[model samples]
Target: MRRVWTSYAFRRILQSVFVIWLVSTITFLLMHFMPGDPIEIMAGRLNSAGMSHDQALATAANIVNYDPDASVWAQYLDFLKGLVTLDMGNSLTSPSKTVFDHVMEYLPWTLFAVGAGIVLATVIGLSIGMAAAYRRGSAFDHAMTSIGSFLTGVPNYILIAAVVVIGYTVLGILPFLDMRGRVTAGVEPGFDPVFFGDALYHAILPIIAFAFTATGSFLLNMKAATTEVLTEDYVTVARARGLKPGRISRSYVGRNAMLPVIPQVALQMGTLVGGSIVIEQILDYPGVGQMLMSAISDRDYPVVQAAVIILATSVVIASLIVDLVLVKIDPRIKTEGQDA
Candidate 1:
């Protein structure tokens, strides 16, 4: 048991768990410290819905599973207990649904949009970066580097704005108004092509925005990595062996060059997930980001807390997975950890 604590994977998993717990605790505290009282807010709505003041207060308290008379510490303990049980109680604003239900309903859309964008960006960036590196000092290489630098320097929101304006107002190429939600009206979700196609159609803009901003970093990094790898002795040995250019590029250059850029994928996942809030709002797509904004506006404490926890958990898990993958990609990481 003591030896397990020294293991890199075990330590990383423990650290990730700690980070998640810290995030959840902070979110719970922030919600509590916010100006409005969720119970009162719910009670007021109930009062306006034909219930007497006392009845509304009692009903709201019961529905929210929050006792106004309880000590703050007691309430916090209950919150933690609920978290442990995977029960975040019912939303103060939407008493009929649990916070988990709301999170589950909306999180997948954000995941789909952001996940697709990351994969597209990785492919485009890695391919272009490698090509540019091989042709270093040429006009095409210079052009690509300049474009990548510009893209990297600009904020994602700016890129998204540019995409919306150019595609909608200037070019009239994108049907901006028609592509406003996750699916067209009356399109029931199923395993069929229609539902999947329409969902992708609606998500295209957000995906493009994400990919556009992210591609620059990947391109720049991959280019640098590939350039550095080109000078290594092993690559020279491969060339001296009279290997086919394509084979040398794939086996010798591409595989090693990708090592440095692989970790960036996990980092980008977290960043894109956070950025999805504004992008989703601009695109008017129904996702967790929009749900989070709505919950914040309505002071729906449970929902807000749950959304934050979900996002934090995703980032932590991604980082953990990347850490493990790095050990597999470059065994030196695992060896170093064991030594430490």
Candidate 2:
């Protein structure tokens, strides 16, 4: 058992490294192969500021450490050097700012908005799903399944739009819900009550929009897993032993059923980092996903590459954690790994 665990741990570390490498390599190659030149995009901005096209192009190339005359191999080597030094280069559109700065500024917002949403969804979904499963084949169970399925089919952005229309435009009840930026414009920046309260207020709509979309899938997954767990022999034994219904539901069924949801929660958190792009855009919330979309549009290679790498690394690490957790939850996972 010890040997199997050690092997699994080592294998997971290597797999995580490979996943990051593969994702970074693919992003780099695909971006480089794309038709638009980041240099040109930069130069276009320069031209708008009155510089001649040829001169603007030359200046932009020098600023970004790119040489159109250089071989692709040489450019790739430079990129690797930048990566090693943690200098992800500069944004083409925003020449004065580095990709690292952009990420630091925006990544936290994504974490706040999407992270809160996923956590809420997991908690709510697990509770409701377990409850629904306890009354399997009842009207409540069927209704929940049907509603979850319907909501799961709708895209998150559409929900965001509908929420904006209904909450702000139609109802006007949430007057403090600012749809643009991370906080109210005049709020002092700090951990003070005013700032934090405003920040939370601003985040409410985006978080709700994201959570509403995320909950449905989690609900369905948890419902299925819980239903399966309730049918297991241990649950039957608990019932036969004259355990109280509530006690059996909580200790025997809920405890065992939650095992599957734990690893899934980790995986979902990873994907949430990338999946919140549309929600951010709609809400005008400043986040890494919003930054990434702008970078792609402006052909900001450094920002785009850095964002992709960060997201990929996040996913890989989360997946590794999930694997370790699964082994801890179910020892048979180690045996399965060994067999594979």
Candidate 3:
């Protein structure tokens, strides 16, 4: 067992290194080739105040605290070196905060929302799916399938937009989810209850949007898995053996049916925090997704590269967890001598 785990960890570590490198390279390239100059983003107010474009550009360079005259290759090397120090340099938008500091402030809140949404979606989706499969052609099955299909067809951003308008305009009750918080003018936040409450209040709409969009896919997948499992030979045998329906249902059907979804579930959950940028921004949730968006808009190379590396790390870790879970749930994984 120790040998198996050790081998698995070693393999995952190697994969992680490759993923980080790939992500870093991609992020660097994207930021490098992105449309619009960082100077424009940095000197927006100056431009509005009638600064010439050339003047604006130079000012932007000063604000970025880097010599834009440097070769792209040299800038990239510095960005990569910053990764080693966990120094994401400065954000053109925030101006004052390093990319690392900015992301760190917002990541936890997004993680909290994504974590809750995943747990809720999986539990609800699987339960509904199994019940529907058990009832195959019943009214409940049709109802759920119809709803799932309806939700799955719509783009997630639309749902987020709707949630924002409805929650704020129609309901007129929930507090706005401002990126960061709704602090008194100029007051710094220390994650106190006030800031936390403001964050939570705003999280509601984004969470709902994410959950709604994500639930449909999980339900559809689970339903298909359940249907297939129900028709399996083991399930047939269990029924023939006169095992109690619930036992046969859980052990014979649900267990095996859940196997195929294990990988997808892990991947989706891992991505939830980083992937819901549209929803996060629409609802103004202070999360990693929004941070990535800001980094992209500002052409903050160090920040973008660091965010990509973090996301890649998360994905690799999730994939590793999925593999281990697969081994545990299905001993027939045949990993014997090929432990890793």
Candidate 4:
């Protein structure tokens, strides 16, 4: 066990778990210490619906599965217990639904959009960046650099807004109303092509918005990395040995240049996931961000807490996976025990 502490993968897993626990705990504390009581707030709503104060209070407690009279520490323990059991209780506002149900319903769409966008951005960016690096001082290189700088400087929301305005308002080409949700009104989700196509159609705009800014960062980083790799002795030796340009670029340059940029993919994914809130709202898309916004508005504590924890956990896990991948791909990246 003591030896395990020095293992890099073990340390990363432990750190990820600790970070998630800390986030969930802080979210729990914030919810409890916030100005309003969730049970009281629910009770007030029930009272407005003609229930007597005492009846409303009792009903609210039962519905929320929370005892207002319990000590804060007791409640905190219960919260942690619920987490362990994967039971976040029922949603406060929509008492019929569990928080997990709500999160699961919407979380996948957000993940899809972010995942698809990052992948698209990384591929296109790396290719263009590599080409630009190879053609260092030419017009294409300068043009790409300027475009990348502009994209990096612009906020994703601004890009989203521009997309909406141009695609919907000016061009009159985009069917904004039809593209609002995850699928067409009557489409049942399944393995069918129609369902998949429609889902991608609705997701396209948000994906574009996410990919738009991320591409620039990837491009710039890949360009810089490729340029640096070009200066290395191995690359010069490969050229001196009369290797084909394509072989030298692919086997020697591209592979090495990608190392730095690969880690950025995880970081970019985290950023895009967080930014999904604004993008989803603007597009009126049904995803975790939209659900979180609605939960916060309705003071639905369980849903809010669950949504936050899920998002945080996704990011932490992405980062951990990237770190582990880096170790696997790059021999120079020494794990703690490897040093000995």
Candidate 5:
């Protein structure tokens, strides 16, 4: 068990490194392709009388801690140096804040909203799917499948649009979705019910929106996986051995059936964490995804890079987690001698 865990941990580290590399390179290149200079964007509010194109270019170069005329290799080395030291550079729009600082400011919003939403959705969907599958041909099973299939067909953003519009435009009951603003309008006091209550109150809409969009996917995936598991030969043999209904359902059916869903669960968790930018935007929740959008809008290269790197790291780590989970749940997956 120890050896297997060690092997999995090593692989996770390797994948994490690869994702970090990919994210850094892609972020750097994408920043290069952006329409304007980080320097101009950073200094715009302060320097209303902006610099010339040349000056703006120079300012951008300075803020990014790079010599504009330096060789690509030199810039690459500097970039790597920054990466190693965790120096994510500066945000052009919010010149006072480093990229890391920017993300730090907003990450918790997403953790509470989309992160929790995904977990909630997964738990609910997976449990219900298992139930539906086990009760196949029953009215409840048919109802769940029919409803889930209908919901799963719609794009998440469309759902987001419909729901947000209804709430904001027609009902006017909830605060409109806007990702950039904090619940307390800026202050986050520690361990106070007033502060926590305001935060939760604001979080209510975004959480529901995210849950609605995510639950369908979870349900569909779980149901499909469960169906496939039920058809497996072991399930057949479990019944042949005269296993009790509940025991066979749990030990043989649900456990083995959940193997495929495990990998997807990890990946979806990563996506929920990283891909909630749209939800955050609509709802005004301050998360990493919202930070990415802000960085892009403001041409904050460092902030954008930092956010992407965080997301990419999550994906790689999730994949590794999925691998380990599969091995843990089913010892037969590992090569001989891997299991004690």
Candidate 6:
């Protein structure tokens, strides 16, 4: 068992490194060759504010570590060296801030919102899905399945826009919910209830948008898994033994049905940071997605590169962790791996 786990971990680590390196290289190349120049954009803004063309050009180049005169090969080599040393350097838009600083500043809030949304979606999905399976083909099941399908198809940003418009125009109320930001201004940042409550209040719309859209897919998956498990011979044996229906549903059917969903959850975890970009922008939420959008608009290459690396690395690591967890949870996986 130890040997198997050790081998698995070692293989996964190599795979993760390769995946991250590939993604990082692609992102770096794209950012470098993209039409807009961060230094030129910065120079333009500075020039507008009365700085001489020469001064603005020099300042911009210094801040972003880019020189139009320098060869692309030289720039690429410098970027590679910085990456190897874990030095992402300064942001072109905000020269005072390092790439790591920007990531640390915005990533946690995204994690909070996305993590809460995923958990909420999972609970709601699994509960409704299991019930629908028990009543498969009934009116209730059809109703739930239909709603889930519709919700799954709708994009989360659309949901956010719709809710904002409805809340303001139709309902004639807006401020009561504190619909933007991680917290209301003037609230002290702490572990206190007031601060926490305010943060959660501001997060409600973004969270709802993510959870509602995410729930539909999770619901459909859970329902399909439950349906298949319900027809299994073990389920039949459980029913024939005069087992209580609820026990059979919960223990025999529900437990087995959840196996497939575990992998889906891992994939969701991987994408949450990257996937929240649109919804976060619509809701004005402070998160990695919002940060990435702002950085892109400013042509902040280092920040953009860092954000892409973070998201891709998260996906690779999450997948590896899920693989190991699945192996632990299912003996069939172990047997298959051993045979291989």
Give TM per candidate. Answer: 0.96, 0.88, 0.77, 0.95, 0.82, 0.87
lDDT rank order? 4, 1, 6, 2, 3, 5
> Which 10-residue span in candidate 1 carries the lowest summed lDDT?
155-164
Model 5 lDDT, residue 326, Cα = 79
After superposing candidate 1, which stretches have Cα over 4 Å from the reference?
none
Model 5, span 294-325: residue lDDT tens: 77776667787778777777667767777867
Candidate 3 lDDT over residue span 1-340, tens digit each: 6765556446666777788777787877887777766656777856887988789877767666556678988888876777778775667667688777877876777777776677777888788878888888999999999887877788767876776577668998544534333233454567688766655555666666667756787788889999998888888888888899989977888888888877777767665655668767666565788888887765665567667777667677768777777777887673562543
Worst 10-residue stretch by lDDT in candidate 3?
Answer: 177-186
Off by over 4 Å in 3: 1-9, 32-78, 93-96, 166-199, 334-340
Full ranking by TM-score: 1, 4, 2, 6, 5, 3
- Tens-digit per-residue lDDT, 1-340, candidate 4: 8777777789789889999999999999988888788788889999999999999999888878788889999999999998888788888888788778878999999999999999899899999999999999999999999999988999988988998899899999989988999999899999999999999999999999999889999999999999999999999999999999999999999989999998998899889999989999999999999999999999888889999999999999999999898888786775444676
Writing each residue's lDDT as its tens digit, candidate 2 over 37-114 gives 878878888999999999999888876767778888887787777776878667787788777887888888887887
Q: Tens digit of lDDT per residue, candidate 6, span 155-229? A: 777877887889877897866346688888899999999999988998888778778866887899899999999
TM-score of 2: 0.88
lDDT per model vs. reference: 0.90, 0.81, 0.72, 0.91, 0.72, 0.83
Per-residue accuracy of model 1 over 3-76 as CA lDDT, tens digit each = 88788889899999999999988998898888887789999999999999999998888888887788989999
Stretches of candidate 5 exceeding 4 Å from the true structure: 1-8, 33-35, 40-62, 167-181, 185-187, 192-194, 231-233, 236-244, 336-340
Q: Evaluated with TM-score, which candidate comes out highest?
A: 1
Clashes of 6: 0
Give the clashing residue pairs of candidate 5, or none. 42-92, 177-282, 177-283, 178-283, 178-284, 179-284, 179-285
Give me the candidate number with maximum lDDT.
Answer: 4
Query: Residue 336 error for model 1, in Å?
Result: 1.6
Decide which is better by TM-score, 4 or 6: 4
